[model samples]
Target: MRPRRFGARTGETQLRSEEYRLLRDLISERLGLFFGPELRSSLERRLRERLGVRGLDSFADYYQLLAYGAAGHEEWDEAAELLTTHETYFFREDYQLRAFQQEILPLLAKKERKRMQIWSAGCSTGEEAYTIAMLILDSGLFEPLADWEIRVHGSDLSKRCIAAARRGIYGGASFRATADVARGRWFVPSLVEEGKSGVSASVRSLCHFAQMNLLDDERTNLVGKCDVIFCRNVVLYFDAAARKRVIDMFYERLVPGGVLLLGHAESLLNVSTAFELLHLKEDLVYRKPLASTAKP
Candidate 1:
C-alpha cells in the first residue's frame, strides 16, 4: 500500500503507508467498518485532530497508544466517533412520519391496549425520536390514553451523539425542515449564549437518549420490547450478514403487530425472512407478524 501524500498547502498531513494499513485493520476488526483507498484522505483528516490532541506526530505511535495505553478507552471512543457518520435532521423523510401519524397512530389508538413504545435505533442527535414524539403529540390520540405509557427511547453507537441528544439543544440548522406549528408546539427557544440559537423544552422532554452499540446483544436486550422500531439508514453501513442479524434481533425486540421502519433505501428483500412487508397506502413499512401468522 502506498502512503497517500498530502500537499503542505492543504494544511493537512497524510498518513504513512504503515499507519493507514494499521488504522484500516483496527477499524475493520473493532467495528466491522471498512474504508477503501478513496476514503484515505478523509480518514486521515479526521484522525489528524485526534493526533494533535494526543500530541502524537505519527499514526503508528497513535495506533499503538490506542491499542495499548492508559487512554486506550478514550482512543477507542475517538476512533468510533471519527468512523461513525451522524447526518440526521428532524423529520428527515416526511413521508414516513406522515404514514406513522395518519395510519399507525390511528390503529394503535383504537386498540384496547393504548400504550405506545418506540425505539429510534441508531438515533443520532435525537432528531428522529423527537420527531416521533411530536407526531404522537400532534395526532391528538394520546389524551384518551393519558394513563398509557408513551416511551420514546433513542440509542446510538456514538456517545457524543447520545450526549447531544440528551442535552436536547440543537442549532437553527436542525429546525429547517420542521414546520412552524410543530416547532412552536414541541420546542421552546432558549437564549443562545455562544452565538448559537437553541431549541425548546417540549422537544427535550420527549425523548430518553442512551449510548448503545447495535451490535451488542446485551445492550439490545436491555431496550426490551417496543411498538415501533426505526432502524433506518444505520444498517446500510453493515454487510448483509450483519444486517440480517440486526433485523432478526429487532424482530424479537418488537411486540406482535409492531412496525419496523427502515431507511427509504433499505429493504428486507434479501436480508431477513423474519419480517413481512407491510404496504401502507402511502408508504411501505415492515411488520413482525404475530407468531400465528409468521411463516414456518
Candidate 2:
C-alpha cells in the first residue's frame, strides 16, 4: 500500500510507502505492535504527534531515530506508549477470573511448590495484576505469610505505564466493573486525588510492577518461571512470527501443569500448539501438562 496522503489538517505528517513499511516492520520487530494498511491513517495520526514533539518533518527521520538512534531505546519506550492501548479496569471479564478462582486455584494449590506466582503479562497500569491478587485472596487457598509464597508480577512495555502501575492508585473507569464491596475491602480512599482510590497495601504487597519488552530475552528470563500467566489482550497486536516467539517464551516461563489465561477474544489457534486447550466450566484456558515435552 502507498503512503497516506494526509488531509489538510494542521500539523500532519505524510507517511510514505517506504517509510510506512520501515516504521511498521521495525515496530513489529522491536515491540510486536502491528500496523496494517487499514490502520495506516491511525498510525500516521498517532506518530504525527511524536514527529511534532521531535520536530522531525519526515517519517524516515522517526524511523531512523527508532532504528539506530542513540536515543533509540528511550524513543522506543515512548513509541510503545503511543502505539499500545492501556485502557483497562478491575474485574474485567469476570467469567475468566471466576474460572481462575474456582478451577485454576484449586489445581495450583495441589502443586508441590508452595511458592505460587501469576504473571500479568502486558498488564497496563496494574489493574489486571491487582485483580489477580484479589482473586487469590478470595480463594483463601494459600496463607499470605505463614507458609505460602504468593507473588503477582505485573509487567508492561511502557515505562510510564509501569510507573502508574507501581503507584497502585486509580480513578474513573478503572473501577467501573468493580463491586462496591470488593472495592471497600481491597482499596482505601486515596489522598492523591479526590476521586481516586489506592489499592490496599495487602493487595499491593502481593504484587509488583516492571517495564519489560517481551522481546528482551534478558528481561524475560529475569521474570522467572510462573505458575499462571495472564497475557490477555496483549499478544493479539503481534504478527504471527512475533506471536510465535512470545508464545514460545511463555511456554518456557511456565512450570509444569501451569495454566495461561488470555483475553476471551484471543486464542492459540494458528499461533502455537504447545499449550493444551482446557475447557473449564466458565472459561477456556491453556495449560502446560505435568509431563510435557516438545512437539518436535
Candidate 3:
C-alpha cells in the first residue's frame, strides 16, 4: 500500500508513507512487533506525542532521529515504551493460574531439583510476576525444601515499564482482579502515592525486573534456564515469523519437561511442534520433552 497524501490539518499531523514504512520496518525488525496499514492513523497519533516531546514537526524528522541520530537508540527506548505499554492487572487469567498452582505445582515440587526458577516473559508492570510468586507461596509446596531457591524474573521491552515493575507499586486499577485476601496478605499501602499499594517486601524479594527485547538472543541468554515460562498475551501483536522466532527462543530457555504457558487466546497450532501438548485438569499447557522420552 502507498502512503496516504497528508496535508497539514488544524491540529492533527499526518504521517507520510515513507516515514511510516521506515519506522514500522525498524520496529518489526528490532522488536518483532507489527502495526499494519489499518493502524496508520492510530500509530500516527501515538507517535505524534513523541514528536512533541522532541520538539519536532514531521514524522520524517522523528524517523531520521530514530534512524541516524547519535541519540537514535535512546529515542527508540522512549518510542518503544509508548508503543508497547499494555493494560494489565494483578491475577489476570485466574483459570490458568489455578492450573499452575493446583495442578502444576505439585508435579514440579516432586522433581529432584530443589531450586525453581520461573520467567514471566513480557511481564508488564510486574503484576504477572508478582502474581506468580503469590501463587507459588500460596501453594505451600516449597515448605518441605527449606533451602530451595525460588526466583521469578520479569522482563519487558519498555524501560519505563521495567522501572515501574522494579518499584513494585500499583494503583487501584491493577487490583481489579485481585481478591481481598490476597491483597491483604501481600501488599501494603503505598507511601509514594495515595489510593495505591506496593507489593510487600517478602514478595518483592522473590522477583526481579529488567528491560529486555525478547528477540535479542544475547540478552535473553542472561535469563538462564527456567522451570516454567509465562508469556501471556505478549505475542499477539507479533507477525507469524516473529511469533515462531520468539517461540523458538522460549523452547531453548526452558529446561526439559518445563512448561510453557500462553494466553488463553494463544496457541501453538502452526507455531511449533517441538513442545508436547499437556492437558491439565483445569487448562491446557505445553511442555518440552525429555531427550530420552522425545519421539523421533
Candidate 4:
C-alpha cells in the first residue's frame, strides 16, 4: 500500500515517502536502528505517536525536529527507546547459558592473577547481567564471597531502562523462563509492588549498569577489556554496516580467548569479524583468539 500524504491540519497521520526516507536514514545513522521498506507502516505508526506528543502535524515536521532542532540530540534518545526492542529476561536462550556454565566459565577459571569482567552489551533491564552473576556464583569458581574483582557490567542505549535496571526490580514477564528454585534463591519479594521481585543483594553486588550507545567510542573504551561479552538479540536491529561496527566493538572489548555469546537468531556468518567460530557441545560461540592461536 502507498504511504499516506501529509495532511494540512493537526492530528495528521501521513508519512510521505520522502519523509520516511529522511527519518529512516536519520534514525539509522543516529541510532543504528534500521527499518526496511516492509516496516514502513510500523515505523510511521510509531512516529505518528511522537508527532502528537511533540505537537507536530506530520512525520516530516517530526523528522525536522529530530534532525535539526535544538533538542534533536535529546530527541534521539526517545526515538532510540521507542524503536528498539527490550524483551530480555533472566536466563534467556537456555542453550547458550548452558554452554557458558558448562564449558566457558571453567575455561576462564584457568586465568591466574587476573580479574574477570563480563559485559552485557545492550542489556535491556539488567536481568542478563544478574543471571551471569548467579551463574558465576553457582559454579563456585570465582570466590564471589571473597574480595575478587569480578564485574558484570550491563549497558543499554535507553536511559529509562538503565534507571529501571539500577532499581533492580522486575515484573512477572521477566521471570517467566526462570525456575521456582532460582526465584526463591536469587530474588527478594518486592516491597513496593506485588508479583514483582528485586534482584538479591548478592546478584546486585556483582553487576553494574550504564546508559550507553554501542556506536559511542568513548563510552565503549571505558568498558575496558572483558573476559566474556553477552550481546544476545540486540544487534539484529542494526543493518549490515551497523552490525559489523558492533561486532568490531565487541572484538575490541573482549580479551584474547574471551568468548562472545549471541542470541540463537544472531550469528557472525556474513560479517567480517576477527572472532573465530568456537564450537561447544551445547552450542556455537565466537572467541577472540589469543596471540598464539591461529584462525580456525
What TM-score, computed on C-alpha atoms, does each candidate reach? 0.84, 0.94, 0.91, 0.92
After aligning candidate 4 to the native by TM-score, how far in Å is the CA of 172 from where it should be? 1.8
Q: Which has the greatest TM-score?
A: 2
Tens-place lDDT digits, model 4, residues 82-117 = 676678889988888989998999888777754789
Estimate the overall C-alpha local distance difference test score of candidate 4.
0.84
lDDT of each: 0.78, 0.85, 0.85, 0.84
1 versus 3: better TM-score goes to: 3
Give the clashing residue pairs of candidate 1, or none: 187-200, 188-200
* Off by more than 4 A, model 2: 1-11
Which residue runs of candidate 3 sit more than 4 Å off their true CA positions?
Answer: 1-12, 292-296
Question: Per-residue lDDT of 1-296 in model 1, one digit per residue for the tens?
Answer: 01123322265566888899898777655555555677677668777878889999888888888778899877877778877778888888999889999999888887677667799998988888888888887788888445667789999878999988877777777887988777766766556545443545544555788888676798889988888999888777665556777788898899988999988888888877777788997799999887745541
Q: Which 10-residue window in model 3 sums to the lowest lDDT?
A: 1-10
lDDT of 4 at 74: 86
Give the alpha carbon lDDT tens digit for every residue of 164-279 in model 3.
99988899899999999999999999999888899998788789999888889999999999999999988878878888999989998999888999998899988888898999
* Clash statistics: count for each candidate: 2, 0, 0, 0
* Ranking, TM-score, top scorer first: 2, 4, 3, 1
